[model samples]
Target: MTGDVRGTGDGRERRNTEIVLTAMRELFHEKDLTALDRYWAEPYTQHSPRMASGLAMLRAAVPTLVGFSWEARRTAAQGDLVFTHSLVHGWGPGPVVIVDVFRLEGGRIVEHWDVVQDHVPAAETASGNPMV
Candidate 1:
């Protein structure tokens, strides 16, 4: 109620977006899910095909991965929604690109959605005559 109440909701939503992404980046690289309890609402529902809907499942399954690092490329927010595009690098299965969307309520992440795409190998250049 202090600073620009009209835009406050949108501003907080955007701020929460960055906060959530930062937390996720830290978790992905460090494998520390402790921030989830602090940043996410209870019974947070993530619309990921690979992750279960509850925090317990996340705590149990995330560490099973060999290595995972998520680097966020961009973020945009409107109303209470935040959209992010990111690239994930690691040595486990392979590199991946992830696009994520988050919905925040009262500055807390309430729901999440993401799509993961495997990084494609670069095309080989054709060189009829090899030059050193």
Candidate 2:
């Protein structure tokens, strides 16, 4: 619970991270793209190759999403940076393990980056632990 952003223990950075990540989860899982405007800055920076920079670009691509789902397994915040480890379903060929990093400014997300890898089958793992 020490690094948890959603835990009851209080901290402004943790609270802000939780709010933004919850909004993002809502946008992807609930198909409420409008939440982006509330949680993201106008000229948002993107480091993910699959996405273009800016909020407008994101809005433009939303309609093309056939199906999306995000299940966050962990969230942590330190200073202005927040990170989330999650399982993303229906985004590509199969489920993906994604670790997203966000930089917040004035409680809104202004920059973003993510590392996405296809979920490996349990039998393929050297260790028995699940990806999520």
Candidate 3:
């Protein structure tokens, strides 16, 4: 809202974040990976180790996923940077904490970075520190 993606209101940019997250929720809810392409930019870049860099490859890998559910919380944005702290649930594994950082260019996400940590057993995490 302040740094890159301009415009104001009840924060339509914030709503846009929700839209993408909702799309992802629905896609995973229905186990439809093909829809991912619709939400991603071409040659999308990812900083996650588990996912490949291209949207197409990521889409092709979605069918293998099962019982994945997630919710985005604490979403905050300033300009093109939107940060979300989320809880991810899955059958293949238990719940995990996901920190998702997005970089927007022209209102479309051109890059993404995230870190997934297994649910801490009542212990504080040392991750999520500023990485400069």
On residues 3-47, what C-alpha lDDT tens digit does candidate 3 reach at each position? 223334457567567555655665666666656655557658989
Shift of residue 66 alpha carbon in model 3, Å:
1.1
- Return the candidate ranking by lDDT, descending: 2, 1, 3
- Per-residue lDDT of 120 in model 3: 62
The pairs that clash in candidate 1 are none
In candidate 2, what are the lDDT values of residues 79-112, reduced to their tens digit?
A: 7788888888777889999898888888889999
Error of 3 at 44 (Å): 0.1
Query: What is the alpha-carbon lDDT for the whole of candidate 3?
Result: 0.64
Clash statistics: count for each candidate:
0, 0, 6
Best by TM-score: 2
lDDT of 2 at 63: 66
The segments of candidate 2 whose C-alpha lies over 4 angstroms from its true place after superposition are 1-10
- RMSD (Cα, Å) of candidate 1? 8.4
Could you tell me how far off, in angstroms, the CA of residue 15 lies in candidate 1 after the best superposition? 1.0
Residue 68, model 3: lDDT of 68
Highest lDDT among the candidates is held by which one? 2
